[model samples]
Every structure is written in structure tokens, then in C-alpha cells.
Target chain A: MRLITTYLIGLVFGVGISISGMANPAKVLNFFDVAGIWDPSLGFVMGGALIVTFIGYRYVLKRPTPMLSQTFHLPGRRDLDLPLIGGSAVFGIGWGIAGFCPGGALPALGTGSVDVWIFVAALLAGIVIANIIQAAMARTTQATA
Target chain B: MIETVFTPFQSLFGGALIGLAAVLLMATVGRVMGAAGILSGLLQPQDFQDWSWRAAALVGMISGPAALMLVTGEFPAVQVPVSTTMLVIGGVIVGIGVKFGAGCTSGHGVCGMARLSPRSIAATTTFMLTTGLTVYVIRHILGT
Candidate 1:
């Protein structure tokens, strides 16, 4: 039942991405192009989503616990760390180059483009490498201590 | 150069849909709808109970465009402006970056800001600035 709800939510999210023209790499690239011919449509998309989520979170968090899960799994960290900034910067460069973020890229696979597949594969590889590095760091720390 | 087009209505409408999806997931399963996190969890399954919902969300996401095509008899046109090599490079970096940062646009940009998270705000700002700079370098400075 919970899984079904999540699925439905994902479906709506995908449709929203498609309808918003976010699934199109061209549209996404235009959003970042502040100097050249720019498109502010994605701003509206972000604005619209933010407004809904802003209001929605206020109402929902008051309930103490979620409907299906035992507790809400929100991020608790507050510090502005190196990983956050560096990671975001790296992600941004990639986004600017490819014009496809994770959310935009995933739904785009439905278009049956080979390019999406290549991007997705490379994306997975990146994630795997990061994970391995993280694990190695953890092991090294453990051994040192 | 690609022509710039604006569609405020579509963006708002689609963004609302995305917001609603996020809200639904939060309300129902009590999970933040971060696409990268969801995909990562699916890839690395920490627990047995986690994969089901993650997989379901992905399936739902993939089916979204498919369903749209079925109803409208057409799919939205997509164009990859960058070369395949560029695409792969971007994908890998984004993948690594998201992992290190702990969120992406949906996670930090949408849901994080809503929750008023300082980390998310910082992350989002950093990425936006970097993306703008990257674009400037590529288009204006390098003239690529």
C-alpha cells in the first residue's frame, strides 16, 4: 500500500516534469543561459513547486508522524560544509554541460533516446565510484583509530 | 545556437504536478522525494524493506512519460545539445556530486527549501551559481 502511494507520487512527478518542458535538455539549458537568450520558464516551475511544498510541509509536519512510515526522514544537518558546496559545484558544472539533472534525466528515459541511456550509465558509474571512495575512507579511518 | 522559448503556464502547471507528487509521497510514506536518493537507495539497498517503494517510485517516474504518450498519442520532444561524450562526462560528475552533496535539485532545491534547511539553501545556491558560471565559461568565454 505504501509502495503504491510512492509509485503514484513518482508518476505525477514524472508527468509534471514532462509537462513543464523540464524533460527537454534544450529547455533546461536555456534556464542556465543568463547571458544569452534565456528562458525563465524553469523559474516558474521551481516557484510553483516551492510554493506547494512550502505550504504542504507546514501542514504535514504538524502531525508528528507520517501516515505509512514510523517517522519522517528529513535531513537534519545544518552546517555549510565542503562536501555540500563542492558537490553542488560539481553537480552544477555537469548540469550546465548536459542540461539534465537526476529528476529531469530519469523521466527522459521514457523518450527511448540512446543518449539518455549513455548518460544514465555514466551516472551510475559515478555513483558507484563515489560510494567506493566513501567506503574506503571509512575503512581507513577505522584502521587508523 | 538553440532558440529560447518560454512557456510560463506549462512550467507552473507541471511544477505544481511535481509539487503534488512530492507532497503525496511525504504524506503517504513519510519519505522525502529526492530522485537521486531514491535511485541510490535502489542501487545500494541498505535494508530489505526499502527497495520496494524506491522501485515503485522509479517505475512510476518512467511510466509517467509513457502514460502521457498513451493518452496524447505523442511524446514530448527531447534534444541533447551536448555530444555523447559530454553527456557521459556530465552524468558521471553529477552522479558523484549528488552522492557527495547528499541531494540534487529535487532533494535540495524543492524539498529542502520548503523545509527551510540551511544546508540545502547553501547547496542550491552553490549549484545555481556554478551552473551559471559553467555556462558562461562554455558559451561566452570559451565560445564553444
Candidate 2:
């Protein structure tokens, strides 16, 4: 019951981005396209996201936790380390090349284009591989610790 | 700072939509409402109970954008600067990075970091720096 709704809202956001010209991979590519009339719609998406996230948390914070679940599930803590820096770089590079970020991928797939699907498959493979690597690393760390 | 970073249209509509969706998801689904986690669920074969919602959510993500464009009007076609090979290579690298970091941008950057998760902060910062460096290298150094 609860879970269904989450996906629906997520879908709404995904669709919103797609329709507004944010989700299109080619369009996303346009921002990095510095040559033409650079379409900065994606930036608007992120910027738009940043604003909503800011206000949303503010309201969520006052609630003692959240109505959906337990306490306000703010992040666990803060640290600047290798993994963080590395992952973001990967994200940026990937974005530059394909112009298909995760969120944008969703709408692209919705368009039912072959290229989008190819990217999606690749993206999923990446996720699975990452999970496997992380699991392996955890095992190694635990054994060492 | 806000205005400088955000466009007028984005600040109002985008922000409102995000807030609306976030609050709605929490109310209806009882989840933190992050794209990375939700997509993960779709990727894995879930127990019948778990999989349906993920499937629906995944559908929503794709369909939502599509539907909007159809109704409103249309935008120009997409275009990529680099070759397919480069794109694939970058994706594979990002996958490795996400795995090493134990989360993606949406996971750590938006969801986890907002909660003050130490791991997320580190992860988000790292992702940002890497992105900046990579862009510089490609555009400035490599001049690609």
C-alpha cells in the first residue's frame, strides 16, 4: 500500500522531467553541447530539485520524524573520503559522454527508443556490478577487520 | 544564492513538484523517496509483494515525463558530443564508482545527505569533485 504510492510519485517526477524536455538524453546532451543555444533545462531540473529538497526537509524536520515512517531519516553523518569523490567523478564523466543520468534515463526509456534501452541496460549492468564489487569489498574488509 | 543558481521557472514549478511528490510518496508509501533505491528494487527480482510497487514506480518515472511532453508540446531532439564508446566507458566507470561509494548521487546526494548521513556527505562530495575534474580534463586538458 505504502510502497505503491512512492513509485507513483516517482513516476510523476520522472514524467515531469521528460515532458519538460529534461529527460531526453539528447536534450540532456544539449547542455554540454556548448556549441548551440545550450539547453539548460537539466540544470533547471537539478536546480528545481535543489529548491524543493531544501523546503521539503525544512518541513520534514519540524515533524519530529516523519509521518511515513520513523524519525526524520536525515543522513547518517558526514565525511569526505575517496569513495565519495570517485563516484561523483564517475557520474560526471558518464553524464558528459552519454548525457543520460539515472533520472533522465527513466524518461528516455519511456520513449521506447532503442538507444535509450541500450543505455538503460548498460546502466543496470553497472548497478549490478557495483553491488557485487561492494559486497566483495565488504567481505574482504570484514575478514581483515 | 538561490536565485543565482535556480531559474525563476525552476524554483517555483520544479521545487513545488518535488515537494509535492516527496510529501505524497512519504504519505502514501512510507519510504524515503529516492530514485536510486526505487530503481534498485526494479532491477532485482523481488518477492511478489515487493516487486509490484517497484514496477509501477519505474513505469511512473518513464511515463510521467513522456506524458507531460505529449500534452504540453515538444522540445528539440537530443544530441551527444562524444562517441558511443566514450559514453559506455564513462558509464562503466561510474558504475564502479557507485559501487565503491556504496550509493549513487540520488542516494547519497539527495536522500542520505539531507538526513546528515556521514557516508552520503562523503559520497556526494567525492562525486562532485570527480565530476568537476573529469569535465575539466575532457574539456580543458583533452579538449574533447
Candidate 3:
């Protein structure tokens, strides 16, 4: 049941994403080429997402407990630390190079683009490496709030 | 209106809609909303017997674009071609990542981080950092 629900949510998000991107691809196109084509479109994409997200968050929080559950599972920590900054930087670098964020990538893949596939390959490898590293670091770092 | 050509309202709009969908799914539907995780679960098919939503979600993921194309008349240009082998390998790796990472970019970055989840923040960051670094090393530094 939980698994199935997760899938639906993802599917909805995926649909929402395509609607968002299909409407404004140039913005997504710009985020990658800071110097070249220089499309700042992704900014708009982020903005649109933030708009929907803010409303959704409020809706979720308004409930004494979530409609599906008793309470919303909000995050505890607020402070942005070293890991946050480092991870964002890494993400930015990847976005700069491949011009594909994971959110954007799936829709891009549906088009059956070769570039999307290659990027997906590299992204998968990156995910695996991170998982391996996380397991190893879990022994020492123990993520602090 | 002139800016519509380049603003990328779609991605953000999509994110927001998904945000709503995610919240609803969790609060109402009791789902977690992880893309990579869901896809992997489908490919593997657990013995436990839980797949209706999973199958539906995957179908939705694949079809959303087509539906959009039906209305917008714009589809992905889809340049660059990779072998079936590469695609399969990539899918497997991503599947493994979902198993270990506990979420996909959508689940963690969009949904979890927005809700201020600490684990999600960590997971999202890890994904971003690795992806960024790898792209640089391969496309620029190493010139793959």
C-alpha cells in the first residue's frame, strides 16, 4: 500500500514536471549554459515549483494530523552545514556540465534522447558511489543536526 | 508573455503540483513518492504482493509526457543515442541507488527537503554533489 502510494505520488510529480517543463523548456535549457546560450529559464522552473510547494506545505501542515496519517513527517534540523553546501556544489557542477537535473532528466529521457541516457548512466553511477560512501561514513560521521 | 518562451515555468509549476500531489499522497493516499525507488520496486517485483499503485505510478511517469504532447504539440527533440546495454546498466545502477539511498531526487530533493527532512537533505545533497562532480570529471576535466 505504502509502496503503491509512493509510486502514484512520483507519477503525479512526474506529470506535473512535464507540464511545467513542456510549457517552458527554454528556461531549463538556460540553466546549463551559464556562459554559452545563457538561458536562465530554470529559475522560472524553480519559481513555479516553489509556488506549488508552498501551498502544498501549508495544506499538509494545516492538518492536526495528515489526512493519510496522524501527522506530517517534517524534518527536524534547520541549520545548513558543510554537507549541505558541498552537496549543493556537487549538484550545481553536474547541472552545469550535463544540463540535466534529475527532475528534468526523466522527462528528457521519455523523449528517448541519447544525451539523457548517458547522463542517466553517469547519474546512476554517482548514486551508487554516494551510497557506498554514505555507508562507510556512517561509521564515523554520524550526521549531526 | 514574451518571456514564456524561455521562463521554464513548467519545471517549477510541475514541482509545485507534485508537491501538492506528494502531500496529498502521503496524507491521504499514504505513499512516500520516490521515483527511482518505485521504478526499481516494479522491475524487481517483491514476493510480498503490493503493486497496484507502483504499476500505476510507473505508467503515469511514462505517459505524462505523451499526454502533454497531445495537448501542447511539443515533444522532446531527443538527440544522442545510447545502446540498449548502456540503458539497462544505467537502470540497474539507479535501482541499486534507490535501495540504498532511501529515496530518489524527487522524493528527497523536492518532497523531503521541502518538508525540512534532515535525512532527505543529506540524501539529496549526496546525489547532487556526486552527479555534479562526475559530470565535471567526465565531460570537462577527463573529456569523456
Candidate 4:
């Protein structure tokens, strides 16, 4: 039951991404290209998604526990950290260069494009590297303590 | 360059669908539906229960285009404007950024923002600024 719900959730999200034309890297890049022939479609996409999610989350959170899990897995950190800001900046630079956020890119993988595969491979490598860096940081903090 | 088309209707409808997906995930699994986070979690799952759903989600994500094709009578279109080297560089940066930032567009921009999280708001703002500037520098200054 949990697995089925999870799969359907993903399918709905993927379909949404496809219908929004976000599966196309050029469309995403054009949304960023303000001075050029800018497309406000992505903005509308975000806005629309925000409206629904904003309302939906409020209701969903009202329940004491979710149907399939013991507790909600929301991020609890409230502090603004260097990693958050710096990482986002770096991610933005890459996004502008390639026009693929993980959300949009995941669905694009279905396109079977060699380019998409190459990008995803690098993305996976980056995740591994970041994990290593984070582990080392934790170790250093522990040693200092 | 592929012509940039405005799609207000389709964008809004699709966005709503994405939101519904998020809501559904939250209602059932009690988890935020962040794509990068899901991918990473899939990579390093704590248990079979953890691994199963993430894998299913990814498979569903991959199958999205097929669903779209069924409705639209053609596969959704896509184009890569950058070279292979650029794609790899961008992918790596995005991956690292997503990990360190703790979320990508779906996680931070959509879910976190919906929850009115200060961290997510900050993260979203930071990335939006850089992405715009980077594109300006590349398209205008460098004329790429």
C-alpha cells in the first residue's frame, strides 16, 4: 500500500513536470534568460504549484500522523548556514549552464538522450563526493570536540 | 536556439498536478518529495522499507514521459543547449548544491516554501538570484 502510493505520487509529479514543459532544458534556461526572449511559463508553473502546495500542506500537517509513516520527515533546521547559501548559489550557476534541476532532469531521463545520461552520471558522482565531504566534516567536528 | 513559448495554461495545470503529487506523498509517506533527496536516499537507504518507496518513485518518474505521450500522442520535447562537458559540470554542481543545500526546487522551492520555512525561503532566494545572474553573464556578457 505504501509502495503503491509512493509510485503514484511520483507518476503524478512526473506527469506534472512533463505537462509543464519543464522536461525541456531550453525552456528552463529561457525562463532564466530575462533579457532574452524570456518565458514566464516557469514562473507560472512555480506559482501554481506554490498555491496548491501551500494549501495542501496546511491540511496534511493537521493530521497527527501520516497514513504510512510514524512521523513527518520535514526539515527541522531553522538556522541559515553557509552550506545552504553557498550550495544554492553554486547550484544556480550549474542550473543556468545546463537548465536541469534534479526535479526536471529526472523525468527528462526518460527521453533516452545521451546528454541526459551523461548529466545524471555526473550528478550521481557529485552526490557521492558531497557525502564524502560531509562525512569528513563530521569526523573533524567530532575530533575537535 | 529553440523558440521560447509561453504556456500559462499548461504550466498552471501541470504545476497543480505536481502540487497534488506532493500532497499525496505527504499524506501517505509523511515525507517531503524532493527529487534530489529522494535520489540520494535511494542511494543510501536505512532499510528495505526506506529503499522500496524511493525506488518506486524514481521508476514512476522515469515513466512520466510515457504517460504524457499517451495523452499528447507524442513524447514531450527536450533540447540540451550546452555541450557535454557543460552538462557534466552543471550536473555535478547541481548535485553537490542540492545535497549541501538540503533540497532542490521541489524540496525547497515547493514544499519548504509551502511550509513557510525560513531556511527554504532563504535557499530559494539565493539560488534564484545566482541562476539569473549566471544566465545573464553567460548569454549577455560571454555571448554564449
The global C-alpha lDDT for each of the candidates, from Candidate 1 onward, is 0.88, 0.59, 0.55, 0.90
lDDT tens readout by residue for model 1, B62-115: 888888898788887687878898899999999999999999999999999899
| Candidate number of the best TM-score | 4
Instruction: Rank candidates by DockQ, best first.
Output: 4, 1, 2, 3
On DockQ, the leading prediction is 4
Error of 1 at B35 (Å): 0.8
Per-prediction DockQ comes to 0.85, 0.35, 0.27, 0.86
Give fnat of each prediction, in order. Answer: 0.83, 0.44, 0.34, 0.83
Tens digits of per-residue lDDT, candidate 4, A61-103, equal 9999999999998889899989999998888888888889999
Q: Candidate 4 on B6-93: residue-level lDDT in tens?
A: 9999999989998999998999999998998899998899999999999999988888988999988887888888888889999999
Q: Tell me which of candidates 2 and 4 scores higher on lDDT.
A: 4
State in Å the error of residue B90, model 4: 0.3
Which of 1 and 2 is ahead in DockQ? 1
Candidate 3 docks at the CAPRI level of: acceptable
- Candidate 2 iRMSD, 1 decimal: 5.0
Off by over 4 Å in 4: none
Say which docking band candidate 2 falls in: acceptable
Error of 3 at B138 (Å): 12
The C-alpha local distance difference test score for the whole of candidate 2 amounts to: 0.59
Error of 3 at A101 (Å): 1.3
Poorest 10 consecutive residues by lDDT, candidate 3 chain A = A22-31
